[model samples]
Target chain A: MTEQRTRRIDVPVLARVEGEGALEVTIRDGRIAHLALRIFEPPRLFERFLVGHHYSELPDLVARICGICPVAYQMSALDAIERLFAPDRQSPPARWVQRMRRLFYCGEWMQSHALHIHLLAAPDFLGFDSAPAMAARYGAELRRGLALQALGNRIISLFGARSVHPVGARAGGFRRAPSLQQAGALAAQAEQAVPAAEDLVRWTAALPLPAHPQQFNCVSLRHPAEYPMIGERIVAESGLDISVDDFEDHITEFQVPHSTALHALLEGKPYLVGPLARLNLNLDRLHPGVKALLAELDIEFPSHDMYHSIVARAVEILQALLEAREILADYAPQEPAHIDLQPRAGIARGASEAPRGLLWHRYDLDSAGIIAHARIVPPTSQNQPRIEADLADALVGVGLDEDEATLRHAGEMVIRNYDPCISCATHFLRLTLDR
Target chain B: MTMPPKPPAIGARRPRLAVHKFSSCDGCQLSLLNAGESLLALAERVDIVHFAEAGIVDEHAEADIALVEGSISTPEEQTRIQAVRSRSRWILSIGACATAGGPQALRNLGDSADWIASVYRRPDWISALPASSAIGAHVPVELELPGCPVSTEQVLAALTSLLAGAAPLTEQDKVCLECKRRGQVCVLVTKGEPCLGPVTVTGCGALCPGLGRDCYGCYGPAENPEVATLAERFGDLGLDAHAVARRFMYQQSGAQPFHRAARDWRQRARPAAPPAPGAESGAAPGPQPDGSTDSHD
Candidate 1:
């Protein structure tokens, strides 16, 4: 043992993920010495840009932040701003708006999740370089995946008029309600796809994921009555429950040296967010249909194995589809799609579960409905520390002395497992090696 | 130049396609993915050697056509775009970010360092340039398709034409033209909505205007058009000088025509010198309202 060998593993630009990021694993004494998930996705300075805009513009404006989950941004922004301008939110009309929002969010989760499972994560398990590279062999499965994704897009477009950066959502409600004819047709389609979604869960469960379980706190929004798409309060596996407004107090977002995105430490410790975390904490809140589907699968929630993330995503797609079907089934053409609001002043904070995880927004508005300042805490930033932690633990599990390519692949799988929305976080990865 | 569109793969090697990102929402890339089966069919027609989001990460891979998204916002990105240009035969800059500098380019009108400090805790950790710029500002762009998320139709049409070795048709017609062509009653004229359709290029089929909302110029300026006049009209529509200036500055703030129009309006409206893009960068509208305020209240 004259000199402990030193080497480095480098992934210059992370592939098959949402936004740009890099990872570096340093091997010293044949153990993982250092790990950094460098989120190099350029910060667009969204909060600063929001400063002078009118309250009405927020939905469309924040939607531009991340194309993958524009709905989440729109929903969260509206949730904050609307809660400020309009106090009477429990009226029948307001409840109508809430139901529509939940349905719209369902579409987004469906599209985002289907995309992750098929195009991004599936190839990793199937031993292919890319989804298209696996196209010829897995044609039907790929088509099924795309079809589900297309259906999700249709549901979003039904309300949004276009899926990516949809223009439908507004302060009080939507810009316009989708027609009954279109809404009914989509509901019928969603109903038929429930079994297809169930198939997806089984399909993901069969994937040869690595059985590497680790301990980390799981956090998600937990509502009393429903699986929270728009949540009331956040509850973690460690029983750290708090209101969305208390977020800044409990979850401190501090800048890190290696990444452009800030690292979020919940009470100064790394905690997990996104589908796995949501499933672990709120498995009981899932719809009966979803629960039955889960009952058929062997993998149970509260699963600490990070690979179960893909399975979580599949389960969520089913959950979204089932809910979308139920809500859309009774859809009607309302006279006015949106509720009008008078301008006012105050701090506005709203939180919702994006497909990736919790998205929280706080806006300070002037009396004239102008945004004075804004701050957004996207999920990927919160998960950054946890990702680095998981990478260090899992890298050793796969053997530290393994060749660079093997380690690189394993590292990518772990990150993609989170389905990290790096662009949303001012976020994401690229990897480098040192030994 | 107008070689009758011969089907691609006549006798030459299949063209390779690559997609790249700089600083964007990843919408434009998703537009390609959103093409669904057509995208998979595209994989058959060409080698998709790289597209980071969809799992091909051959960074140095060469290609016939490269679809680049996002704005160049950092020193490293300035160097990176040149490498992308060197590797690809044809480069199509997609979305407002890649073509017009996007909304982030609003800060291009201000000191970016100041903006970063206002937005982030540790400004030292963030590596950003003074200004965000379109890819063409740094490198030669074969074509620029401007949209907030870019139109999938335009991207698909461009792909087909480029693969056929023909120049993809670039639409320079104003949104007003498309709006009228689609029989949308002028919201600006009829409803006194401050629409940007007359100045904005047609790509979205005048979608916002059709939706009875003012055209926000998601697709930058349509070649050379009457921007100042339209912006002036916004003031006449009961908007104050600040509101009028912001319309031009909001979406494609770094595009030359819109940038100039916004600056001119702000200058004319203010007696004193106009402030920077985010004049109150350090401003935080105070703190919490005793922490929580529910809707029921």
Candidate 2:
């Protein structure tokens, strides 16, 4: 009789994914038996602390949930509180304020994508230990990436008052608006970075991506007039479209014994969100220049190829740069950056496209505008289940007989494709083997 | 000032720099990456043995300088920090979270398990200490840089100073001083806003006040802050006692001075007469006439 073969692989710590986590995979009799992605980061319990705070504090308070995407948190919180205070959809902030909000979001996308593409994910593809190591061979590319990231930070500072955890955004609109001169200066910077972003797109499009195609339920916010960065409805390719108010009803979060970050399921199944989902759902809504560039590059959309996320991020960087330039060209300083509104008892919901994917926030305010309860669902948590599913499937494809390094590398690639913000997800994993 | 002793030189080896995370938003460490050109320059001078955010992993590697971000809020983390301390020659606690337990430290005000129950359906699955604490509380720290997310310039400067065998010089002055240096008008005086600039630290370059908003005290507290005076000033600016307490309690609730001030203001905000039976209502402590609730208690 053949002896029963058993093997276990332990990734003691996961690197470059923000915060700490580990992955454990066990194989028995040449079949994958057990897998777990553990998140061991201590719980901050932001939702609980948010209780008893004033409505005005929600934006700033929620921003602390994730440093990499503070703008997403602020935007979501503002949307929810503003909807509650101003139920009339017609009475949204002035066109300029709305435009500035998108522009601010553009900065975040640029900064986050640039960081991930150059510093975090690129190293994996290049077979380097880290970006610093890659810099030795790709010096010019690294500089361009940093310059683009710096430009993003500048734009964030112009509106947010600081790059990380910006305090400029408030419940109604913003704490203050930048002057025309300031906006013009930023526009000049954006113009300078446009060529670099174009180069980035071309470069990423040329990368040697692995062909690991798989069916995915792509999810993103959708709007009628434009590509959705901030929108009212959550749409999925699998015939799932619901109002932001019904998000909790559609998506459920459950705690797994192995991970501190709660896993999320859409209609009781894993789904994907982020650049790929946004592009897939709103290909027609992309800017004309973006479409023209894609056409020139002979690239197709709605592809199931996960590795193409790097290229998608680069395309977004270009789009964000162009959009920022256009918005800043018509810059005007508006009075009353924020409108004063009395908070009333009500529940409100907000959702916006963070760099990674859709970030949703819900708040319950009391009669006196004090927060009675708060719930925040960051993109990373929503992607956690999807990442695990991708891992299990990819491992099966890679075969259990492969070396542990090969399996670990494949697993890291899958996780990094989602740009998982473990800090935002509030967890890490410690892989242990019992063989 | 007398010059400090120069760090001993290793014959042929560069210093190994390691960055550790506990419970933070990852912003403070990102500041190092945000340094851009300066960070690359620093990388040339030192070996980055471990920085998970940067894709570098060397968990057990010994470091010459260890920059720690976030606060300790779990038993496992407490053990991890001690292990990091044992392997490092110098440990510099970075950001508000590492220096004063961060905004999440607000959980220290109430039971952490209760907070978990309020947020999650299965609180039994959660494992956390009762209070979030700064790194210094568990082990010795060579230095502390305080900010909600520390400024990138400060991070670069600290690194440069350390490389040059000098102590990183940090100013302990209030944000008000920085505002004055920048020739900016006081939002508190001009707009009658409840700014914490007078008591908050200055590393942020007076960012909030310069943007025409009140200082929200993201830098925690300055050295020997006169919190009672600021509370009195806030009271004069139409903030009720509860509101005044909240200003101190929100961001740096775990810091000693801020924590004490919050408690003192809450005491002052208490009603002169006890509430009648059935009047508790479970409503937040004080309700202002302006339709805002001040529920610090």
Candidate 3:
């Protein structure tokens, strides 16, 4: 008679992700039976709390959703509310306003991506307990990464006054505009850091990554001429294109038993978003210099491998640095930094690519511009389902007989690849096994 | 330019520093990582034992100083905080969420269960406390740093002070004091803007007022805030009673002074219709009971 045994791998607390979570995998008779990326973080209930706030307060209020990507939240809220104020979209915002918004977004991408690549994700690749431990060996590399991040923060401060939860962005535009001198300083810093960003691309590309290529349905915003950052039409690799207003038709969120965060699925299946998706969908839209650098480095494009996100993020840092310099060079102090507008009763939706992935917001406003109904879908929440699907696939190859530490490390690596901001998800796994 | 002095070594064993999170945006903790070059320097001086965002998890490790972010909003978190307090030598509550329950504490105003049911389809699966509370409510805090997201320089200063065996320097003065020092014109007096600088705390370098806008009070309340006076002044600037109350209650809603000021304005905004004449005069509606001092006897 053969005996059947059940083995369980439980991670009580997942480290390195933005917020609190756990992973529980149950192996029954040498096969993966159950897997859950449980997010037990206490729900902050941001959507409910936003119900009674005035439209003018949305920018500052939504920015508190996630610290690492406050700019993303503020920008998305502004985009949504502005649409309600100007439904025609015939009179676009001023050229200066558009340029400044991109500049602010560039700062966020640089700071957020640099933090992920250096401090959060690098430890996994280097076999260190943490970034501080990795710093002892890779001090110079870490220094360059941090310096680039500081430059990003400096640009944010130029417009927003402070990096974290900046108050510069409002409904119509920024509260104030940066002078030519401030722009000049940012330009000089960006120009100096361009080489470092380029180095980061090459450095991350050279990291030892496990090649586990699989087809993924990539989704991101697509602009006609520019690399999509602000607001644009949503595009998917599987021939799905829709306006921002039509996002609810294509993507649906549902509650799961184990997690507080609602899992987002595209057409009833897991889909990928963020840097990897952005690059795969908009590689041609990248700057000429960025394209040339990619070619020179001999890295293949349209990669299905999830680990390539690190390299994609590095490429984005380089692109952001170059773009920031160009914008700063062309910047001039424009009069009336913001245009005043009165809010009317209407419903609108706005979506933007956050440092992590697509962040979408919808608002139904009353006649007095008070929020009637509000819905926010952060990138992390959308990515949670895809992360779980990827984990299930990755763990199948690992032998059931492997030690617990090795199994847990493999699981953590898989989760960190998405740079899951469980904090943004606001959203656990406890393991129970039956033998 | 002179370089800042290196952080002095405390003893033969490096002092362990652990950072814990409860319910926050993770911005305050990120500020520590965003210190860039100085972060590496600080790393050399102290042993960072537990910082989950940085991929270091040692929750049970004893530490010399523990910097905690966010607020407690769950039963599990409530128990976890007590455990954190037991293991740490000194606990520094960082950010507005840790010091004053943050913006999410607005849920304390109404029923949290109703809020949860409105958002979630299956509210039974969700487990949360009725109110989001600051760390001080759960455990004794050695220090409190207040901000929507704490300033990185302030974080470094606090860490440096602890290493040097000195108290962290903080200004108990209002943001108005910093605005004066920076030689900035008062937005409230000159522009008629409803700035909270008069009652808000310093440490943000009077950022909003410097940027040609009204101060939104991201750094919570200052010592001895004349909140009623400021609320009345905001009303004078064309903000209605409700708007004035919101201004005080927005970011640091859980703080005692801000909470009281907001409540008072709410009462003043719509007085309760004089309580229907003699309803509050202790008059019996249907039948009067016989008034007797020794009825039982």
Listed per candidate, the RMSD to the true structure in angstroms reads 6.5, 5.2, 7.3
lDDT tens digits by residue: candidate 3, B152-251: 9889998888888887776588999999999998999999998999999999999888888888888988888898888888888898765786787567
lDDT over C-alpha atoms for residue A127 of model 2? 89
Model 3 ranges with Cα > 4 A deviation? A1-3, A87-93, A427-435, B1-11, B270-297
Listed per model in order, the count of residue pairs whose N, CA or C atoms clash below 3 Å is 25, 8, 4
lDDT of 2 by residue, A178-241 (tens): 9889999999999888889999999888877777888889999998888888867999999988
Q: Which candidate would rank higher by lDDT, 2 or 3?
A: 3
Per-residue lDDT of A14 in model 3: 89
Model 3, C-alpha of A410: deviation from truth (Å) = 1.1
DockQ of each two-chain model: 0.38, 0.44, 0.37
Judge the docking of candidate 3 as incorrect, acceptable, medium or high.
acceptable
- Judged by DockQ cut-offs, the docking class of candidate 1 is acceptable
TM-score of 3: 0.93
